[model samples]
Target chain A: MDNTESIYEKSVVPNTMGTKSFNIDNLFLVAFFGGVIPMVVLGAKNAKWLNISKKLIYMLIIFGAALLVTKLVFVAMITSGSLDLDNTTLNISYRVGSVLLFIAFKLVLNKAFHQHMVVCGKMEALLKPALIWIVVGIVVEFVLVVAVSM
Target chain B: MCEEQYANDRKMIEHYFSMDRYEDARPIIENLLLSDPQDPETLYLMGVVYLSREQYTEARELVQEALRNGYNPEYAFFFIGLTYQEQKMYAEAEDAYLRSLEINPNQANVNAAYGYLMLLTGHDEKAIKLLDEAIRIDPDDSAVNDYVYRFYLAKNDGSNQAQYLQRTMEIARNEQEKLINIAVYHLVKEDTKTAEEYLRQLYLLDPTNKHVLEVLEEINRTNHMLFLPNRLIDKIGGPAVFYIGFIILVLVLTWADINSIAIVILALYLITAGYTWLAPLLYRLFVKGKI
Candidate 1:
């Protein structure tokens, strides 16, 4: 018992109850509304206020490229007359492929971006938008599935 | 048994240890051991110091000796588990952890350590259950929050990862450690630029940290797009020729009533020739023998 007390006293335990906080840049919160247009508008409006790193831009590019490739491939197949399969199946395949690629891209980008946010002390600011984007992706997929079934 | 004198000695020993005055603590520990050679608590305390010193072999021997000397079995088992863990002996470590838990399941850091073991062994669900159990039992431990952060990071659960990392950063040991953690978090995600910012902060805090310097060097080495060949199209002069040929070929086929198969051959020839000639040159100039 005495040994335990001694050890406890010997350890400099950090105050785990420090006011839990994160950096909140309003410009970041506003930039995450929706759609490509809103994003461009946000960037244009907050060009000076925001600090967009090149790594994030690259992540966006890679993510966008994944979806873009699906379209490019679909267009190529149509132009080349390569599909003898059912049109519906091809359309479904393309759409599903695009959605899956987007999710894959989003997963990677989120991991990268969230880590960056954490390092920058913007962890709390990151979570809300990250959650929003994930929910939006899920809803979009669910709506697409429903539309297809109908 | 002079209980008050023992308590005073214990306080003095703790005072030295807390200040990281290991040199001062050692002589006192030696004196205590000489006086009461059978004291399990003294042996255990020495084992704890050895564990921190990373003398795993000596630590294991000392802790085992403490257990034999009738030390607190739970703590003895816990320290033994920790020694095994440091050595990456998962099976032995798990056995020790289970033994410790059997004695006292509520041992504060044990559940977290075992959860880490579970995670390493690919039982993520079990790991979470145990880790969550640890949190319920000891919510105030920043080390528990760190374990939670590692769990989220391993599972690629971004929101939780961010949340727990934030918690960790709040109570980190020092600016250097916090900066390193942040840098590592970003580095693992391959976000070198963001990682560099944290690493730069760490460098400012401790310029002698080789790990920070190495990561900075690695990021610099990998940012190869800075050296990519530019204006290759202008150098090749292929775009102008291709477009001019395209226009003439389109006019011939659509308006001049030329041989369709022959024009197709000519167009294909232009496309293939342009690629075959320029591709090797570009490859040699930009990509040959480079990682």
Candidate 2:
């Protein structure tokens, strides 16, 4: 066979050949249920699978710090009575904050995630790791909110 | 069975499959499976037979077995995904497609199938990306082009929708295919009058086609004044437009401090939602005699 024909005939590894990573939808679900920390952790794991862990981890740290600052300001506003303690407002703000964080994480990871999917068609389920991270994340969030509020 | 006989049977099975004659291939595949149950190729062929018969569970199991016995893992998983998709078990289908893609990311059809799954599951963003990738890899594939066309149609992206539709038409294998695509394009655009005209031409060309008749009936049903809500929703590009309008109306009312008016608007929104849902069911029941 000619070189071109030989190359064409050779079987390359399928896109599912690498370490399993979570898709964007799963990341969104993790973020929704577990909050930002778990979402970041899971995203970091996916980044690791895609061999871009350092980039994602660094971006996430910056995002986390920014989020902390925002939370502190939010709490300060509530304490100073600039913002009301209406449960609906508080709930909406928290959910919206989580969603925004999810969007930010998705923006950072989108290209890498697409590349990974294009290169390796299969992904691992995020459920087990998400459950663990969610518990830890919720606990941390609860503690942080209480501590900051005080 | 002797090696020569086995080889001949394999060729015959492949030929039958190419001819889309699964029934003709089944007995030979079954005999081969009986002779050597561990034979991965025979197992995979049997899976194909089961798939054609719509015995999805059986098809899936046989393909899994084939994969276990060292059949092509990527193709096997792709087949498994197809079985799941056919049964509308989308989650399972996604997993199988992922596995298949993991093994062979270059498979244009798998990418398109996965993209369509994403679309069905409301992941429009992901669907767009996958469908685009599928088209990039194999632009000539009419099905992939059709999917891209459908995705753009849903997004109400007129230019991209028209581009893909034209591409699909360009690749049409025959006049029948071109006519159907034109009819569908008009139907989705809610130009039912134009759609009906094309369907009539298609009907004249292929009189026994049940799909053409059903669509013609649908057009007839939607012409009634009672079906105006359905036609309006289709023209305005789906229920999402109404939802956005409703949200804006509520926001405006709240901003104006018109609480009573807001309540009335909410009632109106609910009534609109109910009518949109009910009108189609009513049409099916009254016009088609089925829901």
Candidate 3:
């Protein structure tokens, strides 16, 4: 059917009972904006360790923390492997994980944060290490999404 | 005086269009048309806005006015063709498409539309050839794939249908494909469980997948009776892990109910704290300092 016809059908007979339609393109767009772009922006602007060059420190802190947390969750889930897909337990776990990933993404855009601060005259010194944190955040999110889905 | 007023009118028309306030654009465009009744650009633009809103009759009149005024008549033809298609006037659509193609044969949309019109007219072979030509010009043309998919599906030739469906999936280029392909593959293999699992994932990813909606309804109605046999969860190591954890939790709860509850609550708290606080502290202590 044409997109117009499909749209008409959807509007005329709205699927009121079920979840909303998910377009992969839409999902990817959401991820790019909500997860990726913000992370990149934040990573570029943020400073680490009261200096601009210590970005690596920020990267390690976020990634190490996220990785360790994900590992623990994986172990728990593996150990208690249950068939209760009905429970919101997995959903909660994933949402929390995704949010962590989001924060990591923000770290990647750390320079953007630092730059904003600098522009605002809050920080006189620019730390370059924050850039590494941004890269780490982006990589972490990319890996986690692929790993979890797989 | 005339030149300046007309320029201002055009500017005002563009401003309203930019703001996406089409209702506001109408009076300005109409006034422009009244002042300079011979202006093709204003007529064409008015047609375009109306066409976007699916106001076919008004769009047609405005477009024809542009054509009559000797403006870019090919675009007028194209929009008229699209409006005809919207109205399901396939014969008129085909003629208008042909007219537009005659004017601008190189335009991908014209070829794609002509191809789609042919498909709707049951000229499958011609439609396919035209669509292929369009694809060669613009490989990502949506209308061409949509029409071709429709044609093959109607033909009910399994292999051909699958082939076109695969094309559509590729063109779709979304995460939805991840769920869709897995579900369909399992369904074809008669592995209902795996199919159902993928379907569930598909629903979670995008609840709007019509095929998934249908399968979910069928499964629910049958009370999950029609199951695909192949086990994907095992291959992925998800099912086993989930089952083991669930069984252990159940056993612990059954024996020392109160103690298990307390332990569960404590464990939850510890896990949350570790993820949010302790883990970050350890990272800052060791990895952050080192790296």
Best lDDT among the predictions, by candidate number: 2
**Candidate 2, which segments miss by more than 4 Å at Cα?**
A1-150, B1-55, B172-180, B197-213, B223-291
Instruction: Specify the highest-TM-score model's number.
Output: 1
The lDDT per prediction is 0.59, 0.74, 0.55
- Residues B1-291, candidate 2, lDDT per residue (tens digit)? 888998899899989886457989999998988889999988999999988888999999998998999999889888998898776676778878888887778888888888876655545566777887888899998778877776666555679878988998998756777788788778766688998999999889878677789889868877977778756765774454455566678768888999899999999878876886587778778876887
Candidate 1, residue A68: lDDT? 40
Candidate 1 similarity to native, TM-score: 0.47
TM score of chain A per candidate: 0.31, 0.72, 0.28
Per-residue lDDT, model 2, residue B206, is: 74
| lDDT of model 1 at position B180 | 69
Residue A53 lDDT, candidate 1, scale 0-100: 48
Model 2 sits at an interface RMSD, in angstroms, of 12.5
Backbone clashes (count) for model 3: 49
Arranged by lDDT, best first: 2, 1, 3
Q: lDDT of model 3 at residue B220?
A: 53
Residue A142 lDDT (model 1) = 47
- List runs of model 1 lying over 4 Å from the truth: A1-150, B1-38, B171-177, B197-291
Q: Candidate 1's residue-wise lDDT over B1-291, tens digit each?
A: 378877877888888776444556777677778888779988877876787678998999998998998988888888898898777666777778878888776765788877876665545566777787778888767667777877777566778878888888987756765776688679767687899898888788767567678878767655544322223332443333333455456556756566786578677756654564455455546755432
